[model samples]
Target: MSLQYFAGAACRALTARKDGPSLYEVCDPILRQPGSGGDPHLSKFYRTALGNPALRTLLRRAGLPELNDPARLNALRQALVLARDNPTPDWESVGGPIAELVDGITLQHPAPPRRTGAVAMPPAAEIDRVIRACGADLLGSYGRNGFIPTYAAFNLIGDPDIRGREVLMALQGLDARGYKNSTLMFNLARVFIARSPAAAVINPPWRGIAEPMWEPVQIRHRSAYYDAFFTEALLSYLETGLASSEQTGTARAAIAAMVDFCLETSREEVRGADGKSYHVVTALAPPPHPRFSRFFTQIKQDLGFGVYVPDCDTTACSFSAATQAGSNDPILDQPLVDFYAGYQVRAGGNEPRVTVPINDNIDYEGGVATWIDSMAGERPYGNDLDPTLNLDVLEVSFRNLTRWQILETEARLAFIRRIVGFQQRLVLSGAFADPRAHIYYLPELYCAYFGRCYHAFMALPPAARQAIDPGGAFELIRLRVLAYVEDELVGREMNPFDAALALIALGHLGGNEASFAPAVHCIVTAFGEGGRRHPYRAYEWNKMKTPTRILVGGPEVTSAFVLMGLALARRCR
Candidate 1:
């Protein structure tokens, strides 16, 4: 499960406060309980690395205090809290002393300085120039790697949420050449082509002994899920004639790879209700996280070693892009709508088994399930459901169905109602801080996608819009997210990525040009001001278990999102 207990040791080793994720946010272990049969492997050490005597002995020998040293941990935690409240121009380092756990892995630039202040918004013409420049940034974001690459700090803590555990790669973002050239692979397979990471990553400050996840080689992983979203964004801008013919051609070819991946990786004979079977797209090709073998990820999907299964989020994104590109339209081949519809949890028999606290009050009668595989190889698989996945499925399904002129269908209504129910019980409830919200995303991102779909639907004729969202449910959610975006604009400290998401959500559904100015003013202050585009991490870690979990994204996707927000915001006012 979660080796979160190790956060203390990691923090202590890094000479960080015995509290917080200064090193790595209490890490989830990398080791899997390997086997094909029933749940195996016990031992407190497997559950929490601190329980291992050998590891504990190392900590003790290294003169590290008890990991459960409550008083000291809380003191350190409070110190960090105080430091954050009093951030300086350059975020002053709070680290105590470096603990050299691994030789040759000495680090620097792991923690980025806090970005504050505001930048003047450019004039309309200048904004256009800025947008074009941002577009260049977006295009330049794609490296020799053919797609956006995700960076995990060499420290095992996957997400590295800097709020508590801050570290930024020194050679982050694009090099002097105007594209990211540095990537550190934990896997032996050098799938991505980039420069080796400098000795300079601020490794979780090591003041004492710390254990690292001893993961083996990883396989070739082209993140088709991420590519689908980026390709769709590129495809949209391609119509503006912004790219050179050669760049356009290159863009088209990359789009082809994503389409091919989605089509080829689609799992066949996936069972629906009553012995019905259908072809379906899964999140990953074979292993969701190529850091592990197919055997490992397969078992992990079954909660064998990981938290996420082949879920509907990847399916929605991949299928939506493919549909937009006119690649593979398999909706007609199988009972596509019917297959997805059957997965919807009903009030009683079909209702999702409410496992998460967020959905505890909401009856999951019409909600969509996240994981798609109903069964695999004589074993029951697939039951991780969430409300955001419903929004994703609903919007994509509506858009794709409308595209094919298959608007009037029971399944369409089901998808629409699912998010309606979600908005009522979840968003309106202001329980937005639900722990599960960040399971797969930083909460604000859900708003961006929700607004994206709403924007598309609103652009249609009034009659079409009415027919699509007659209940005005989607409108309510849109307003809720829009209001949230407007509200976030005034916050003291804003995550640049969250601000980018806010700009996106606000841009899609129009309020006023005035509302957009503030966040944009704040965001650009951190956007490549003095020189190169620094990597402002989005803090995306599944924070769940599985073979190996690494938070994805670097400056490429961040720049792409900011650029998209800026470009789309132009249509406002």
Candidate 2:
């Protein structure tokens, strides 16, 4: 559709909001449209209009302010100029006053009565059904060599901690399955490792075979791009699982070997114009693997092998290096360095903090493209980058590391604040439009952040917790939960996974039982026939055509998230 079509759709969506328009309502239409699909000139023109400070204020204040009327737009612009020049323009005092229209829109739902203890647990049969459904998905999707098809398998295994003999038996059945790639195998191993250490020692189903296959000798020759971090993480888990000294020794040797191999293949020494030598990990090596670049920076950071040193003022240093590197592509260099430096700062101090400047050079509408270019780096699928998704994953990773004492307290809180800041900008800039009014991806993001926040508050020292505003974070989460309830529960967006995640966050926030009961019931009822499978996508409300299909995590991802929600609920109780 043309820009007008998109703009008109946004306006309709915004004004239709009973609780006043959210920033997402205005941005959703534009975001959903493919970047190259719309009229280039018209898209740019509308972006300029939205970028105008006066027009933006009007749009935010009065929904989409009669964008088609040039006279009204001009009048707003003139008034803004007068206000600037006259310091305090007495427009309110003048007889020719602009009417202030307030909708009195409020999106808040009454808080449910805070549970003194855990809410009632789901029936034993119900829990059993969920466990079975998840197990079936896991077993059904198992590829040869014990690998599952999607990253969701990691979530399934990682999040719930995969207890129960029945689920273990289901996993045991995949022992003979073969992996076509290291990614799948490493993930599969990770799942097994996350199980009880006793289970590994007593029932060693895939361990004997998988351990031999992952021998340092076998993996040493593999490309660093494909195997380094995955191999290291896999071995780390293997060391934890195998109780025997010999087996654990093997795992440790393999880890060291893989680390050395990565350094040899991925590291490059270069002399800058300042005649100083620096070692940095190349994004990829010769004979590139397809998935190489996507994980390059992450793997290097995970393995502790990057030019930027941890715990130093790496932010300034990395940014300086990017400038000195003299790369023709500043757009790519700048964001990549920022991400790298941010992580380094996070890794260095007990309280790691780095600031990522929201580019003012690109207006709100164009920020999406700029964010993609900067953040995605050399990845070919730059346009497909989802800021919410990236931030969610990053926040979770930071939280997990901090919990393990691998990351300092400051690092975890700093990273979380940065992510929250990014989300706040999207809301303020009016770039987070979702016609469904849930911001579509926001519940998931809020769940991730709030979940982390909850755990951090409980686990960190009081002083550390005080450094971050737990109440403010909860307020943001509570508002999003209300939106989720309105759109997904009371309304019909109906994504059980997202709902389940939101439920978990709400429980953590001490949400009143009444407010979240309907959501819990909705999720419980979503259990398909026999509870053997759940639909991969939520059915849209009123047959509304979603801009994109709901992301599929199959049964494994769905059941895992549901189980996690249940687990969280039980904990809260």
Candidate 3:
């Protein structure tokens, strides 16, 4: 329940499902390990012995027949009879040959399998130390002067950031010539690292910043789609981390530049809501920089990169950033509020569609659609409801306080009503764990925002809660959220991906940490021993046209989440 280790990341995991690896398949690498990485009380592996693909593959390849039960799970009551032996071989004499075969033979499956040697899982305490150290190295070594990636691509052993869309290479002047710069990572990273315990060990990365960060110019929705909230994160960064530093004035100007980029580029449109039309910031504002003038503003016209109109995702985040940066402009009043508020799906109207690969959208009407234009227009996009963005809207609606409150009373209440309505839809439909109910973000990322919202909801006074919800609307569902996380712990602890999300959810929900010691040890020992975990696909090929799926995010951000979970675990201990 400690707010000190409350984990937050504006991290995104985007992908358009093109059918390659399931989330479980990506998790196959570590789950097959021989022991509970070191805890003896726990099982040697997360799942049962029959499911260890690598071991079975190894046995098959060595010309030894595997146990051929219907489930491949058998107990040898008499003895392990290897009939291939010329004569009866003693157990002691056969050890060397078996050890030699099993030591480092490569497995065919598991995508990029590791050539593991004699396994001695690291002790629990050692694993814990390694978890902290890995987090330390991730932040201190790379995060010290680097930008976090939007997609945490799990390229564990291959070349790092293989897509060439990284600011890290751009900063280092490496081979990444056409570096696809991110609009939000630097600011987001600053916020995450600063808030985490890692800040105590390393110097602030944005200490000397004085320039407005660039818009997400290189990234194309139709043209340069902008992200401004990571800028707000930067503003939060400068105000909290370096207010008295000499770079304060420069920092403000840099922040203003990005905020202005968001403001000036917003599409001012008259949208109808509450039976009236209001001029709101409809579209994401690209930077006014003339260098990118060739990029088209009328997004519907461009058929090349697929049409990405203004969405609740961008509008809500951009509006939140604007409010935080001290803007009292009228755009924050009716137009923007009503425009977004008008988009939430009406109750009982969400028809089932299987467009996204993650989950079924059954009875999701209260949720907000991804894009404003509902594909009826010339531009073909919309009808997809994203839980991640809904939570983002919910997060800003509360702004770390109890009960959703923003904008004028009438519009704000209307907005909060729909926001809460969609939240109910997500939980009741059982889609919250399905990649945050979409293909673009991980369940972990969704939990990160959900945790914040839950924390804020808990802050409400009892009277205030009763007045708002009337009948304790969220009380039963809150238990559901906690139970869902606890259910995950009951299953086999797979990889750091599951562990990270489970630990963070429990921490946010104020659950007892002692209940999930095995999973915690799994995370600690995985890092303590192998010292390797690539970014598993948090999201997939969100592009309009692509044969193969494209994943994002790097190991550095992956390590940060692991570290965040470890921090909370340490506090509980």
Candidate 4:
């Protein structure tokens, strides 16, 4: 975790000298020979040396030149090259130079914008076209699996603060046509209740499934975390919406039944450090068969019973058996904490709050291994799961709770602060600095930045906002975002979904309305006229060629994000 090593490694990874191989290549040969583990030092470098905060402290102590100074940066790079080649280098001797290098490589803040331009609204006609296209897509894509439909429904129905009548009607039509029973359907019902209780009361969808939805069903373990939160959200919404005496008693009973079922079925008991037993909810209950019993036992032994389920397909199971436990990974635990925090807020009662077990040995090295192992399809790993995407869902839940005033002010502020910290660390880590490392994740990243993180920051109080971004980090982020959109999105053939995401991010970043006109025009043109099916493509990144076409998900997903982009554009306007 030493900052010096982190800075050196980062600089080495980022730079390629004209004279020879990169400093990274010199120090860690395994990066060049990807499949081989010839050097132990190489294996440990990524986890231990990169992104260490201690390096920053050492740089400040050494009184180095500012990060933007070209001379200082060049000198540090040369020193790094020397250090990489020295077999028995004295780190103490190189410490001063390394500090200077570290200082030179840190992310520099951009100057504040000279003009914070007035909001430039997108044209109403264009907005109508995109909205109509999205609505049609949602109708065509109903009953599909994955959260895309749920997301589409929610976006179309609009947020509590932003209402779109046409979108709402599209969703109501789906309901009228009798959408099948699924976790997402229930989740959407909750959203409806939260946004408009009167409408929800009159809605056939909510009324139809209001009682029977509480029954237990086997949900895939991966989806369980979100399903749980949505269920709780529904209950919370029901409590508030049914405040009037006419429907209070029956609604409260149904809500009570649902909560009890969730607790009883999902809870698992584990002993704490104090030798006291506590119950925590598992995302999904393992099947009661001898074949899976042994696997379940292993998950319970290593990371406790409920943090994350280790059971996967046969290939993954074999990998899990050979590798160390992935449950100890912090990324896994953080999301669990996020879900529980929201659940606690939603399920306000005398029930004791669940605390995550702290494993002091969980370090950067372990996280990297876990991530590598998971990505290689050898073991269950949560680190590879983008927190930005996961947090987007949680952020939506949190925002709705806060808006409804269900979450206490202090708790809401605390959650907002945590989210702000997460976003700051993500940006500073330079995770997206490498195009190859983040190409596939660009759309999700954009959605998270604009749809969740930016909104959360804006919701913070003045003092809190200043504390998080005192040095114009937002301005720098905005600049980086603009560069990415122009380089990766504009004039290049990309999926409508990704294009829509870039548009939303641009709107949120406060780019000129006219600049987005071309993109908007592209979307409308691709949407075409009449009932022709908008082509659906899966999301994948091609290193050899830039994507000029959409991948993955149907028109439903594309239209949902398009509508979302338009909604955001309206706000910015």
Question: How do all models score by TM-score?
Answer: 0.65, 0.38, 0.49, 0.38
- Please state the error at residue 322 of candidate 4 in Å: 38
Worst 10 residues of 1 by lDDT: 187-196
- Candidate 3, 288-333: lDDT as tens digits: 3322224443321221222234566666666667666776656565
Worst 10 residues of 3 by lDDT: 175-184
Q: For model 4, how does the per-residue alpha-carbon lDDT over 338-435 read when each residue is reduced to its tens digit?
A: 32232221123322111111111111110111111111232221222232332343344333443324234555445444443444444556444332
Model 2 bad stretches (over 4 Å): 1-122, 139-145, 151-419, 424-449, 452-454, 470-495, 529-552
Where model 4 places Cα greater than 4 Å from the true spot, the runs are 1-123, 139-379, 382-430, 433-440, 447-451, 467-472, 528-554, 570-573
> Candidate 1, TM-score vs. the true structure?
0.65
lDDT of 1 at 129: 53
Residue 84 lDDT in candidate 1: 28
lDDT of 1 by residue, 1-573 (tens): 125634554444334223222121211222223223312222111333223343333222222232246664454334333322332212123221111111112222122234345545556565455455555665665545555544332233223222111111211211111000111111100100001111112122321111111222122244557667777767755755666787788668777766766656544347776567666666555554233446534533332223223556767777777877877555434434566676676666664433322234344567666665535532122244566666667666665665545357765555556556765567776644343343345456667777777766676678766665677876677677777666543333455555667678887867556667655665555555314553332333222211113445545565566666766766663
Better of 3 and 4 by TM-score: 3
Give the root-mean-square deviation of each candidate in angstroms.
13.7, 20.7, 20.1, 21.8
Whole-model lDDT per candidate = 0.47, 0.33, 0.40, 0.34
Q: Estimate, for each residue in 258-314, the C-alpha lDDT of model 2 and write its tens digit.
A: 344344444444432233344443433444321223454444333222222111111
Off by over 4 Å in 3: 1-148, 151-303, 318-337, 347-361, 374-378, 400-415, 429-439, 442-445, 515-550, 563-573
By lDDT, the candidates rank as: 1, 3, 4, 2
Stronger candidate by lDDT (2 vs 3): 3
